[model samples]
Target: MKKSIDYSIEHKKWLNKRRNKKISVTICQFAILIIFIALWEIAGSLGWINTFITSTPSRVLASIYNLYESGVLFYHIGITLLETILGFLIATILGTFIAIILWWSETLRKILDPYIVVLNSLPKIALGPLIIIWIGAGMQSIIAICVLILIIITIISMLNNFLECDKEKILLMRSMGANKFQILFKLILPSAIPGFISVLKINVGMSWVGTIIGEYLVSSAGLGYLIVYGSQVFKLDLVMASTILLCVLASIMYLLVSLLEKIVLKHR
Candidate 1:
């Protein structure tokens, strides 16, 4: 009974510490953002900065409100979000499978390593024109761009994680007569979950970038298209508003990945 009471007290103390830490971080972020906006407003109003080009936070907020009222913001946001999620899911699954295949075949991995590296090193955005031409300039092109951007990164991250698996544990499994498939499923894949989560986190931003670039190149709808349209019309406020919305969406996706990491790591 005494030990149980002590454990309860310890748990409470830990919880309190965590709560305080979170509060501190939140306050710090808000304070910095407030300071930045204040300085930006003052500078723009005082003519120290060009409001027409740079755009102030207040103008951006107003633009957001206007866009919201028109019901156009949600339409673009939804399309971009859909493209990002679809591309992320496709790239992650394919990348994980490729990593598993490479893990199992040293000869194949050796033969493909150089090709993978070359593909990864190439600038993905440069392929935008070709992708649009091949995919016919629409959601398909956007998803294709996002998938291309994410797949190589995911494969590289997962391959490294797989290679770094504990040799002793793998040897023990082998000594027990575990077959290749059993060893991969029971050991390699489980060990790489954390790395997979990390890849997802990275791909969240990349997916957004890919979709936006794709939209910029060729799309009738999406946040990127909005930005392009705003720029063509010389509406800096609209561009700023669209950019902020994109940032918010990417941040939300990143937070989801972070939550997944916590849940998966807890079981580990």
Candidate 2:
């Protein structure tokens, strides 16, 4: 009874230690961000850095306030956010489905392997003009660009994960009279959960990148549009403000993905 009680106490201590460590790391991250902002503000005020070019934190905030007052802040954010989310969902679902199809047919996989590699290697930017022409200069084009950028990546990552499933375990399942479909659901899919989560994480970043790039090419409204306009007009404050907003949005998306991962893993 005494040994069991002692063991429980030790386990609690270990868990507490881990919790404290996580807290400390989070605090440090916030502290570093605060310190960096302070230094940036001080440097700009002292003329140690070019405020006109870099834009101080205060100026950036003021620019954001101006956008809010004009009632356009959320409009631009919503545009970019919507595009990113749509692209992410479409690419993930389509790519995963295609991967499964490829995995199920060895002949199909072999036939498409070279083509897939070629598509993956092609520069997405070179196709941007064609995308604009094909899809037209609209939101559809933006989402299409984002999807094109992410789908190939998703296919490659997921296909590799599915292919890497344990051959021995598959054979054992076969010996037990399990069909391919049963083995896949009972083993392959379960084992690929981690890879799927990883793919989600990658998609979070790629989604943003693709959306921003699309906006750069043909958007009339979005954070990327603001960036392009700001740079053209030399409105450094707007550029800085838009950039900060992008960072915040991207970080929020990534954190949401991480939270999803935690939930899935817990259930797993």
Candidate 3:
């Protein structure tokens, strides 16, 4: 009973230490952001950098406020956010399904291996015009572009992960009269959970890239459109505000994914 109590106390102490470390890291992150912004505002005020081009933090805040007053801020944000979320979901689900199919078919995998490599190496931007032409310049085209950019990478990453499952354990399962599907369900997929999460993390970034690129090509209303318009009109403040908002949105999405990872790992 004494040993049990001692172990429990030690475990609680370790948890507290880890919690404190996380708090310190978070504080440092916010401190760096605050310092950077302070320096940036100071430099712009003192004329160390071209405020017209670089745009001061104050100017960005004012521009965002103007956008809010104009009532178009959320409209633009909603369009881009919707497109990004849709593209992200479609790409992740389709890519994962395709990866599973590829893993199940060795003959198909061998045949498509070269093609997959070529596609991965190809600059997806080059296909942007074609995608627009084929899909007709709208949300569909944007989502298609996002999926095209992400699906190949997802397939390759997930397929490799599935292949990397412990061969001896697989053999053991097979020796025990487990079928391919059984082995896959019982061993392979579960083992590849970490890899799937990693793929999801990567796809988060890729999804944003693809969506932005698509919007760059043909967008009437979005943060991308705002950026393009601001640059054309030399509204650097607007550009900076949009860019900052984009960063904030992406960071929020990433944090949500990290939270999901924590929950999954804890359960596992």
Q: Highest lDDT, which number?
A: 2
Candidate number that wins on lDDT, 1 or 2: 2
Please list the residue runs of candidate 3 whose C-alpha ends up more than 4 Å from where it truly belongs after superposition. Answer: 1-28
TM-scores, in order shown? 0.88, 0.89, 0.88
| Whole-model alpha-carbon lDDT for candidate 2 | 0.95
Report lDDT (CA) for all predictions.
0.90, 0.95, 0.90
Q: In model 1, which range of ten residues has the least summed lDDT?
A: 1-10
Q: Write the per-residue lDDT of candidate 2 for residues 144-236, one digit (tens) a residue.
A: 999999999999999999999999999999999999899889988898999999999999999999999999999999999999999999999
TM-score of the candidate numbered 3?
Answer: 0.88
Best-to-worst TM-score order: 2, 1, 3
lDDT of 1 by residue, 107-219 (tens): 99999999999999999888889988886978999999999999998888999999999999999999999998888999988988888888888888888988888888889
Best by TM-score: 2
**Cα deviation of 168 in candidate 1 (Å)?**
1.8
Prediction RMSDs, each to the true structure: 3.5, 3.2, 3.6
Could you give candidate 3's per-residue lDDT for residues 114-211 as a string of tens digits?
99999999988889999889879888888888888988898899899999998999999999999999988999999999989999899888888988
